[model samples]
Target: MKMSREQKYRLIEEAGEEELALLKQQVKQSPWRQKYHIQPSTGLLNDPNGFAYYQGEYHLFYQWFPLGTDHGMKYWYHLKSADLSDWQDCGIGIAPGDPQDSHGAYSGSGLEHEGQLYLMYTGNTRDNNWIRHPYQCMAVMNADGQITKWDQPVIREVPSGYTDHFRDPKVWRAGEQFYCVIGAQRENGTGSIVVYRSPDLAQWEWAGELSTSLTAFGYMWECPDYFEIDGQGVLLFCPQGLQPESDKYRNIYQSGYVIGDRMNMNTLELQHGEFHELDYGFDFYAPQTTEGADGQRIIIGWMGLPDIEYPTDQQGWAHCLTLPRELHLRNGKLLQKPVPALADRRGSKASFSGRFTGRQQVPDFAGEAYELICTYTAEDEQDHVPNEQSAVTAGQASVFGVELRTGENEKTVIGYDAQTQKLTLDRSAAGKPFAESYGTTRSCVLDQPLRQLHIFVDVSSVEIFVNEGEAVFTSRIFPSRGSQGIVFFAENGAVHLQAEKWDYL
Candidate 1:
């Protein structure tokens, strides 16, 4: 059912106690509730916002619509964690009834200054004519965890050349000055990023549109994040209205990044390379990153996409945040590995090691919420010359992988094809189906030989890190509760394999 405008914009306070209680009951009854990932208790969650480490803890926020399970009247829902494995919910961090954020509080980033964390975000307001007017807003949080929004917007009106689509201000400090990059669209209908300069968090000045090679990319660019890793600059953003080209941009909206030399502060120009997707899966968007206390760059993405109706909507909640990943720049590509701290949540362990030729199932490896690590190596053959025919024969057996959440008539397959040199995730028969038009299988070509698979499976989602994060696939699946089987298979020939599984505590 489509939500009416009034229903969509209703404030949480306007809801009666019975209505709120019923919503909570519906969410608790949902079978798809996440085991370890950060999901809303009620209503909708999207776009990780204001992620930063401050005052001996990690502060993370997301755009939340608490009244229902649709994108309506977003508030900044807060969570804090001493370790990334466990999160403490802090309720609504920023409500949206003020004049600036009359409609909603949108996405942005967080920066820690002297003894405080500064949150810079987009305040979304709609006028009587139903047109958007976005404001670059600011709020400050003390070490005591109290937050206060400024009485006025830091950046008031949209600049001259861009449309009202300007939003998502990501602020960073360079040398003695603070800089911000905002997602924008030109009057000519092309997507771009704009820059703003501020010495303090309050007063700001428009520098100019960021100069990049991408002149006409998409219709709108949202959630722009800028950071430097190992002296290389990376700009991450979600560009909407992209048409599918080969295996790229397969989703309705795409979240990706471009790496290059650091931006020229004076000219605001970025000399960068091509855009590469952060995750290749059915559900990933609006990823936000923050540097840990030890200077490790870590990221968390919304585990669902925009404009897609998920099966969890009927349960009164939708979407979750991906497990936090540690980012590394290796050989000109960003490699993402699940944070090492996650090992703290590991429970009972299981292991299997052998030369397997066909399908094999380990009894202890089946579970709903667990982590699995498997490594495969081709067995060597003496006196057998490596030729095209021999390679073809080997490829047949090399086309091996695992099936997860298997039941009588459903399973999700994560397999690698040596012949095609591709890693594929197929959820066609996984469970209750939605978004079939977008296809069920997503595959990525591997530049190197496949050696390992590190997988994390929750109640309703999966995150696969292939070959030590050379490529990653993150997706949400809706399988029946009885589907708790894990099977491993190889075709035509024997291969050496070692595997381990650990249930999440």
Candidate 2:
């Protein structure tokens, strides 16, 4: 709904000279406004804030700056979904209209108490000396959905030795007392999580810090979530300052967790020394967790990185959330799969069993929008002949390729980069104007060996979840009219393919 005249005037009255300038700057900065791409109606958006499951629905609130592309005062943007795939955007939930949150209502989490939805977030503010201060606060919506916030900040401040960087509180109920973790920076200039205990959800008592390892992993950690997955505990967070570490940290920051043994609640101990990647993809970060109604530990994340320049920003919007993932411990490694409910939206099966030798130029079945899974491996051990490079030939990438094509106007070529020994995706062959607009080339190097590309392509968007959740590449392509037929090429290779089509109606 558009804002009423009265509402607009009220907004104007609420602003000062600086706020007015900032608002004008945000509106002026957009080169484009990306539609249906989950963007702020106005300013900048970052992490998904205040996420939880309630009333048979998954409610996800994100950082929203609806007036512009700048990271101005944030409001909690609301969306809820019953099946995790079809989402209902509920507009702004908690806004920065409150005086206590005049600066910005930063990142946090959501919970339900006494049949009421309660939100806890960092109340960001600047004091007289321009020092950053954070506060934990609460808000609730009545049964009718009319929202109201408490007058005072629930948890006023953290103890000394931790600077104003303390924020992004992730709260959960353990046994009876409510426990929460806040990202903090020590006086020594390192990052940590401070655990706190709150009995009534209002007042909080500071517990101790989690770790002071300072092992050079990353600077301040953001969005810390602790939960038990498959009888074991997992601590998930996005650590800042993490640089490229071999096959990891390829993106700006990382979204991952450490599986550990949970100690006493008051002590806040995690008895594990290892960290793992949450999703090895071009975009994924700031993951949060919630226990599903089915007793499964489910997770969701904000998919765009901070500080990295986004092409979409030119379109007057930025960022999106990753599909919800079900996390599990498999074979001593973390495993993730798209939530099952997404399959319900798969419409119909556009697939059939066929021996794909890549020689078959026909796609068997094709659609402007489709979901296809193609699997491949060496036809035999003898066929695993590596390229003549002394390195990859010395290691791997000696596998086969199962290529995909659409028409002279559109096609996607994919194969392993033999020299790098990494799986690669190619859209170089997606021809014509679409090819020219997209420059017809894209790819992502897989962390592990992937023998398949489980592709989900909507009319304009392509999301390739590689090898059953190992890695993903998401890209957008606009094609000329009447260029929708897809093809498969063996390209001196052989494999099995399943092409699934859906109406998405």
Candidate 3:
């Protein structure tokens, strides 16, 4: 029997304990299942949405396609958290069927207005000929958790002189006015950002456009986000179809930012600096951020890139979210550190420190899901102390770092070159290859000495924060269960080190 649209919406919107238990049973049998990450309950998950802290809880929603591992019609799956560490599934928050969002409820953000939660997202529609019409739609979630979609789109149609590529409205309140920035593409085929302002949340007016003839950005931009930090405005967005620029923009798409002292909303002009990639990793895109109740800019990103295949596709599910990170601005760059609340999961901790002359492997340093922190300096440094020793002489490379998943010729390597100031994550041998289009290695350069490395490893993912979050790399890895051994190796010179490991619950 064909299910009516109302029946389908009822089925999805009311999915609760019975649905979750079944999903848990099915997913528990998959070897690639993550223990602590926010993955899809059944099918595919992408692009976290509606990330807002409200009513003493943090609400997060994601683009979900529950019937399969592919991007079919997308729905929004909602979850709430009290501490941002442990989460409760709130079932489906929005279902597609209404005329406004018949095709899908695409990406957007959340805001708290007058004690109610307001969500603004893109409503994606396609004709039989596959022509696209996107709408900037709105909905309200009352204190009782009932979501009511507004009958019509706040911004009814695509504006003049742009393609239907306009979408992903990130809304925020600046003083008494509500402002939004949406990603768009010019008629001439360059990516840009369009600003909109509303005195009240109901009526919106076009502010202006922010684009560049100064540089060749991609043809279209997606998921544009704007915020203020330390009195500076930061614009972050994802650009598609960008040609590789040396060591940057190497992914299928890129997520980056341009810092500006201020943004002229009416003119859409920004006194900004150069663009910089947010993460240098094999898999990271479509990041969304929110300011927490404590005044920290927190961000979470989809742990998988678009148009890529993963081994987990065979297991009936795919993709997850990176751990939530707190963003800070330091020396004109964004610094991202995993929220300290995550430390509550640490159990059975161990500490190690030493002066290592060469290739040295710490005994009992092995786990698939754990957090590792290390501090070290080049051997030539005369001002350092060494404790508890492990020594060997590996010859001339002038680089230092660690190797993970070291078994059966499958290991993911993260290394830093003091001379070049380049940090790289090489996953050539991590495991099953996903796509040739996404190369096996990604790198970033540090503006200062490489003093510390903080790494978090789940069953199939790795997130590295370098030099107190001066730079970060988040990627997924597929390694055999037996490939859990970790080793630290250095070349040419000795290393003064202090390290700690904590197994995660």
Candidate 4:
């Protein structure tokens, strides 16, 4: 049930004590719950919020609705990780109750200044007529991880010519000034990103919207994050109402970034190049990034998509954060690699290699939680043989990468089509029917010959980094627990293959 203003705040405190207790019990019986990913102990979780390194630990907050599986009475549930691989839940960071955030504490970013940690979030409130009033609110966290909301919002009111869809303020310090970029919508129903500047983090000034090269990008943009990678200013945001292209933007919504050399603070405009999708997969959105203690930019995103029905809802919980990834700018393209710290979770290892023509199941290479690296040398397209079971057209693929999470009746396939130069991840037979809105097949075009596929498989999610992060796919799959088989196959031609597997400890 949707929560009103009063009921949300009242339930926030009362539900905290009771809901968490029952959550611990509900999770034990949910087979789809992740063992290593960050997830809500109960209810629904979405949009990673206020991710920053503070004091001696890394703090990550998420949009949580603890009462049930649906969105209701949003709160910020805080969790701290010393190494980004092991996390400790720290309970509710901010709850909606006060006038500023009476309806919900929406998405935002985090900052650690001096000795205190601060969070700037969009406070969602609704009038009796059901009109939304968004407030860019601020809060602080002590060394112990306890949070205190500021007395009032630092930035109030939606600027003229924009709807109340303005929210998800991402704050970062640049030079001597602090700036925030929030997603907004114009009255004409176009999406934009607006910047706000503050010298002391209290008073904020309108910094205008970033200029777009396209005439119409999307209707509304949500969860905007502005930051610099290397020397390029990266503006990452999720845009709604974009039509799908031949091989891109096939999801209901898309999250991506445009890279530019400089951001003009006066006009709040970014002179950027072409837009690129951050992750090409069935489920990924609302990604946030923070600089690590070692000066590396680390990012984490919700592993599930919006407006889709997940199989986990019946188990009483849904959604999780993708494994933390390190961002890099390589050859003008953004590259995402799973952080090396995750190696600490590795328990055992297995290796195999061979020449395969059709398909071969790798012995002892089956598990719901492990990291797999598959390398294949594709034969010449004209020399390759065709398999009747393959969906790819003739002369398109000489070698197939591999498939994981395979069962007697189901499998999730990740393969390379040489003719089309497309890399595909197909989950049509992964078990359990889902909403028709959720697409089962996702593909990414490759410029060079297929070489390597780095994959991470959790209980219910799969993240594939192709060609050392040249392209990446992050998706959530609901295969049965017994569907843990892995196989490598090539159609019409023989290809050399080497596979390595590491199970999480």
Give the number of the best model, judged by lDDT.
1
Residue by residue across 150-219, what tens digits does model 2's lDDT show? 8999888768888778888888988889988888777776667889888988888888888533345667
TM-scores of the models, in the order given: 0.97, 0.79, 0.92, 0.93
Residue-pair clashes per candidate, as listed? 0, 16, 0, 5
Predicted candidate 1 versus true structure: per-residue lDDT over 358-399, tens digit per residue: 999987989899999988765556633333222223533768
User: How accurate locally, in lDDT, is each candidate?
Assistant: 0.90, 0.65, 0.84, 0.84
How accurate locally is residue 405 in candidate 3, as Cα lDDT from 0 to 100?
71
Who is ahead in TM-score, 1 or 2? 1
lDDT of 4 by residue, 79-161 (tens): 99999999987889898878898778999989988788889999988888888899999999888677889999999989998
Over the full model, what C-alpha lDDT does candidate 2 score relative to the true structure? 0.65
Q: Candidate 3 at 443: error in angstroms?
A: 1.3
Model 2, runs deviating above 4 Å: 1-43, 212-215, 356-369, 377-421, 425-452, 458-462, 470-492
Q: Give the Cα-based TM-score of candidate 4 against the true structure.
A: 0.93
Ranking of predictions according to TM-score: 1, 4, 3, 2
Best-matching candidate per TM-score: 1
| Winner by lDDT between candidate 2 and candidate 1 | 1
